[model samples]
Target: MGRFNFFVAFIFGFGLYFYFDQSCYSYFHKEASSITKSTASGHILAYLITLIPLLITVLFLKKKEINVLEAVGLSGSLTKGFGFAFLCTLPLLVAFSVKFSLNTGLSLNTIIINTISSAFFEEIIYRAFLFGILYRCTRLGFLPSVFLGSLLFGVAHLYQATDFVEILEVFAITFLGSVFFCWIYAEWNFNLWTAIFLHCLMNLYWLIFNVDDSAIGGMYANIFRFLSFFIAIGITIFYKRRNKISLEVTKTTFCIKPKDR
Candidate 1:
């Protein structure tokens, strides 16, 4: 019953946020820009509206006697999350630095709106709320828990591409990226900051350098990105082995765990 309530609440809250964010964001941004006389402020105000769904989820959690911070994976060690993410994404930083020149025109507004806000808010909504509650609270398996959120995450990036082929590529990449983020989130003891920092640093590096206009980059760009992927996986495996911690996502739990049910 608790899991059912949580699932319904999150879906409803996220649905509401998604609708408003998609349909009304421009209006809110325009209104906010008129008041603050700053486009960045407008963007910030629009992004802050994401908190409505977060607060809604928190209310449901409170009713269930769950600690909101821990449940949402916010109580984890920020230092560890940021540190590991930085180490794992070193390849992207180095590769982009060598291959692409610095984007001199990059502004603070771009960093705040594109990298920081997108990373933080998307992770909280998609990974923590959508995937986390489904998997942890409901005991749904990894594949099932991550599928819907990842699908939406992928679809959300379709705006970057016009043609069908490019759209497919963008969707595939972002969908896999979503799954990877969710995997690390679970592996790191459900600490969402890990995913958040990783997403932010990667996006920041991409934005800082003139890598590619869209998420789908050239062959060289993707090469380094894949290297970073392998590095993250390798490091995670090593860490788990050294600490004797079993992986959270395993074959036995790939689908609904009969025992857990």
Candidate 2:
């Protein structure tokens, strides 16, 4: 019954978020603009409306005696999360600095809207609410749990693509990115901050430097991106081993959980 409720909650929450995010964002943005003069504030407020489902889910979990923070992967160490993310993404900072010039005209609004709000909200919505609940709270396995959200995440980035080939490239890269974020989120003991900071720092570097116009980067950009990926994965494994902690996502839990089996 608990798992059933969780699954239902996920469906409802995800649907609500999607509807408002896609359809009602403009309306809320206008309403928010009336209240707050800043466009960034309006965007933030509109994004906040999309989190109604998450708020409701947290309340629902409270009724079930679930630790809301732990369930959503928010109870992890913020410091460790930021520190590890910085180390893992250092390659991007270095590579971009060497290959691309910094944007002298970058604005505070861009930082708030693009990097901070984007990373934080997207992680909570797509990852914590959509993927986390299904994988952690319900009986769904890693693959099944991540598929829909990752697909949606990929599809959401299609706006950046101008042509069919670019569309394909964007979708593939974002989908793979969604999967990588999920893996690290689970591996880091469901500490969402790790993924959040990683996402933020990556976006920050990309925005601060003229790396590429789209998520699908050029060959040189991708080479360093892949290097960052390898560094993150390597460090995760090394720390898990050092701490004698079992990895959360393993072959046994890939398709279905042991209890389900």
TM-score of each: 0.91, 0.93
**Taking the tens digit of each residue's C-alpha lDDT, what string does model 2 give over 1-261?**
566776677577667767767898899988997898877899899988867766676557433666877777788999999999999999889999999998888888888899988998899877876678778766578998899889989999999999999999999999999999998998998899999999999999999998888999999988988888899999999999999999888888888887753
What is the per-residue lDDT of model 1 for residues 1-261, given as tens digits with 9 covering 90 to 100? 566766677678777878878888898889998899887888878777746766566557542666887777888999999999999999899889999999999878888888888898899878987788778876579999999999989998999997999999999999999999999999999998999999999999999999989999999989888787788888998999999999999987788855644
The global C-alpha lDDT for each of the candidates, from Candidate 1 onward, is 0.86, 0.86
Best by TM-score: 2
- Lowest lDDT sum, 10 consecutive residues, model 2, at 57-66
Provide the clashing-pair count of each candidate structure.
Answer: 0, 0
